[model samples]
Target: MFLNLLTLGVLSLLEGRFPARRDPGQRPLNMAIWLVNFASASAAPLVMGAVVAFSRRTGLPAFPVDAWPPVLAAAAYIVAMDLGECLFHRAQHAIPVLWRMHSLHHSDPCMNASTTVRHFWGDVLIKALTIWPVAAIAFRPTPSTLAVYVLISLYHYFSHANLAVNYGRWSWVLNSPAYHRIHHSREPQHYGVNFAGLFPIFDVILGSYQVPDVTPQTGLDETPRGLFQALAWPARSTPGRSAAQGVGAALKAPS
Candidate 1:
């Protein structure tokens, strides 16, 4: 928790120093979402515990990381978990049901460090039911390995930060802010590209890689207005209207 706050504070500072774009109002909304998620984070361990238990019951073979050196094991685990993240991220974009929940993350017009934790709270359970189980079964990662992954996952704050930083040639190897910003780009050309969480190698291999061209504007064309709409995003509908169209109309409606 302390580390997360420190990371958010540091990245929030960097975002101020080198902002790609500013929407001062968005930060408070992102922080509110983060607060809700932080309170809900307690349930994560319980969900993961259930996932691990289910994996054990499956009796499926897991990677023999215990036989490797500690550093090597950790490295290998990170890579595998990153691959899982990359695939699941792609699924989130490709699958409509998942996208309904995921659109909340992409709705942040001012993608900043705080936007890293701006996911809908229900995404936790959705992932627990889907990708988390697969990862648990495949890796059977020890507590230390999971802890290492959590530490590395802090890169997400940096990745989502509103900075114009990108690795030149190395952009294909690691996920930088610029690289990830494209993933959240509002431009149609950038849609469905650059979905890797930590490593971009998976994107390269899977053929979804796209170099960060310009720091494009991020977020949906029609974003949810407030916290209520954001949380109720998936279920929001009106008779004879598509969800997207309804949302668009809602945004256009008078206060």
Candidate 2:
């Protein structure tokens, strides 16, 4: 699982760092900002690992991954984890605070394979805070279980890509880029739809699944983030910030 996640993350970095133009006007995402995001968001797994290890070594059982109550078996836990992620990802869209943290990801003007790597550091911190489900799968995980984690992550990357992978019936069963592109779409209607990481079933059950009746083209269309600004975006963008900007922009007189 570790190797697979490592591979997928590296590929995401490469694509975001050296992006291909889908349109003539689109600029590649700024590398420095992307790095900050990558570094910040990617810190979670490492942090989670350190926390779990330190807890065990210090003999602190509270919040220990190994100390999870046996509420459900491993198999059930995996299924629950998928649902939890879907729910959590959806909440990032539904909740205003989470969306503020997540907006850096959508700030990418263009949607492509590389855009998947663009993220805010706060999101990474959130991920580390949310990794208990993995620990629940195992206090000491097996190779197969780890593989499952990697599989879902890779599946997640592709879902965010701007590729044209036609998955017919499978698209109904699994989350596809076609399905996921809607989540990244600038259109207001598609803004928060389709939040599944792997299993679309969770979305279906939760009534968040949305399949577009017509195909939508994908690519980066926004001005790419400048190196310094993107890195500072989360820090500077307070809840009042968005509100002030929205109201201030509206109050501006027409040119």
Candidate 3:
């Protein structure tokens, strides 16, 4: 717990020290994103706690790893975790209704550490429910699984930040902030690309990955209610905004 707090503080200071990127507080929409995600993260541990307890009580293994080799056990855990995450990510895009809930996370106008917290609780619930099946049958969730999860999450937190760090050619295998910036792109063309969380091997292999050097112009251009609206904007509707912006711009133009 202390380590996490320390990481947050240290990374925040490093970002401030090393870069001239715009801060979240300067943008109302970004602030809203932070609020929503921060609130959800506050409850994340509790949800994880419940899952752990449930796994502990209801889950049991008939045969121990006494016979199973260590290397193979670790390998299986890593494969299962990566496959589960890859599939979960794909599902988020393939399913439209679910995308509505996920749009809140993508709503960040700018990326940063705080952007990691900008997810809707409903989406988190769906995630937990979806991944529970794998956790149920795992018998004993290996340490490799937990290690990979933590490392991947840390990488994601970095990806959302505007650190401007790069791994050059390694970006092909490892996800970088610049790579994920394209994922948050406002242009419709880039929506489904860059699905891999930790590594781009999956995305590249599937022919869904693209690399561009431009920083994305974020915020849903079609909607005024982006992060700030609907949550607080009276009568603000994103569906109406996205729809009306297409057919007749002048007629729907707000004063």
Candidate 4:
């Protein structure tokens, strides 16, 4: 928790120094969404515990990594988790039901450090049921390895910040803000691209990689306007469109 707070503080400073877009008004809404999601995170351990219990009862075999050296085990865990994240991220864009939950994260026009946690509260449960369980079953990482992964994943705050940092030729190596901004770009050409969370190698291998070009405008064309609308996004009615049309529109949108 301290690490997360430190990360947010550092990234917030960087965002202030080198903002990609200057819109202070968006911060409060972003922070509000983040706070709600953070509070909801208390249930994550319980959800994961249930999954683990079910897996144990079913005799689902988890690959053993405890015998490996700490550094090596951490590296393997990172790769495995990152690959799952990349695939699930693509699914979030491709699957309509998932997109309904994920679209709230993309609704932020002023994507900054706070945007990193500006996700639907339900997304945690969705991931707990899906990708995270698969990862747990596959790797069964040690607590130390999980801690390492958490520390490394803190880069996400920087990646989503409003800073204009770009890696140029090295963009494909790690997920920099410029690299991830392309994933959040409002441009149609950037749709369904750069879905990798840590390593862009997954995006490259999966044929979804797009090198960061000019920093483009981000956010959805039609977005939830307030906290209530964001929370009720899936059930909210679109004026002239049917449910199918709304789902189709979400599927057609850029991730």
Candidate 5:
């Protein structure tokens, strides 16, 4: 939590000094989304602890070298985790039912470090319970190694910040802020591209890679009403109605 706050403070200072967009909105929806995720995060350690325990005993094929150096093991875990994330991230866009829940993360008009917290709780839990275990089962890393991966993943907060950093020639190797910003872009052409979380090679291999010359707008046509409405969105969402509209209808509907 301290690490996340530290990164947030640093990136916020950077954004203030050299903002990519001069007039990002107040981001009320983003705040609501962050609060929802933040409130649930109180229980995240409990949930993840259970997951790690189950994964430790899952009986899946484990990576053979149990005594590998911490740095090497972490590097390997990151590669495997990033690959899984790429597939999962792409599935969230390609699969309609999943998109309904995932779309809330992209509805923030103002991009900032806090935008990293702008995810549906259900989506957060689902990814946590499912995706992390799959990689844990495969790698069978020490709990300490897994802990390191969690620490690194927190950098996603930094990567999603409003600062306009592209990592220049190194963009292909790592997921810079600019690379991820394109993933959240509102332009039709940018949709369903740049799905990798930490690395861009997965997108390059899967053919969803894109690097735009211009910065693009971000957000959906319909956005959630408020905190409760955003919380209720996925359950109420329909094909015809926007996610937020469905949430609004659900809020008004008889219990």
Candidate 6:
């Protein structure tokens, strides 16, 4: 809770002083999204806790990394999980079904720290399904490491901020706002690019990295109007076409 407040406070200040764009109208919608996501986050622990209990009872093949030094174990877990996230992010763009749900996040026209909370409720379910399973069976990360990972991942909220910052020579190590902005770019050329969350090295390795010439036009032309519309997006389909087809029209190439 303190981390959430600190992140929002700092990013809000930065964005107010040096916004990438004036989006006063988007503020309310952004906050609504943030609140909804926060509610979802609040319930996530119970869901994950249940999963962990189930995994333990089922005799899942969990790796015992407890014997390793704390620092080394934490470092390894961070890298492994981030790598998995990068791959899953790429899949979110490529798989039509996943894209349907993920589109809500990318629908934010004005990228800011608030845009981090633009994820749909389905996104929470998706995360619950994917992440904990890996953590349970692949590597049993210590509670301290998990807490540290959460703090580091929260920086992603800042990464989406309107601040015009980039890591320059260190872009490969850290994912800068400029690097992530390119992923949110509306251009077809930028589709399925820059899937990194904490590290841009994945994009570099996978050939999805593109240095933005300009901020580029962001968001879909037909973005949802309010929270209800955003939440209902995955279900809203035309008479003849499925939602997947509609999303596929917007996302041309996922490379």
Best prediction by TM-score: 4
Clashes by residue pair, model 4:
none
Which stretches of model 4 miss by more than 4 angstroms?
Answer: 23-25, 239-255
Per-residue lDDT over 99-157 for candidate 6, one digit per residue giving the tens place of the 0 to 100 score: 77777777777787877877778777677777755765567777898898888888897
Please tell me which model should have the higher lDDT, number 1 or number 6. Answer: 1
lDDT per residue as tens, model 4, 224-245: 6787776786665542222232
Per-residue CA lDDT of model 2 for 129-187, tens digit only, reads 67552454234444565566556566666666555554665665887767777666555
Return the TM-score for candidate 3, rounded to 2 decimals. Answer: 0.69
Clashing pairs in 3: 37-117
Backbone atom clashes (below 3 Å) for every candidate: 0, 9, 1, 0, 0, 0
**Which residue pairs clash within candidate 5?**
none
RMSD of 4: 3.3
* Cα error, candidate 3, residue 197 (Å): 1.1
- Residues 1-255, model 1: lDDT tens digits: 789889999988888887987764377778778787765577876887787787678787787867888888878778877887777776666666677777778877778888888888888776667777677777667789889889998988999899889897899988999998887776656666788898888877777788887888777665667888777877766222123422232112111
Candidate 2, which segments miss by more than 4 Å at Cα? 1-21, 24-34, 50-78, 131-140, 217-224, 235-255
- Candidate 1 lDDT (Cα, 0 to 1): 0.75
TM-score of 5: 0.84
lDDT of 3 by residue, 17-83 (tens): 8742563422355446556656665675467657666766875442354357866665565556555
- Per-prediction TM-score, please? 0.88, 0.67, 0.69, 0.89, 0.84, 0.87
lDDT of each: 0.75, 0.56, 0.58, 0.76, 0.71, 0.74
Which regions in candidate 1 have their CA more than 4 angstroms from the true location? Answer: 23-25, 238-255
True-structure RMSD, every candidate: 5.9, 7.7, 7.2, 3.3, 6.7, 3.2
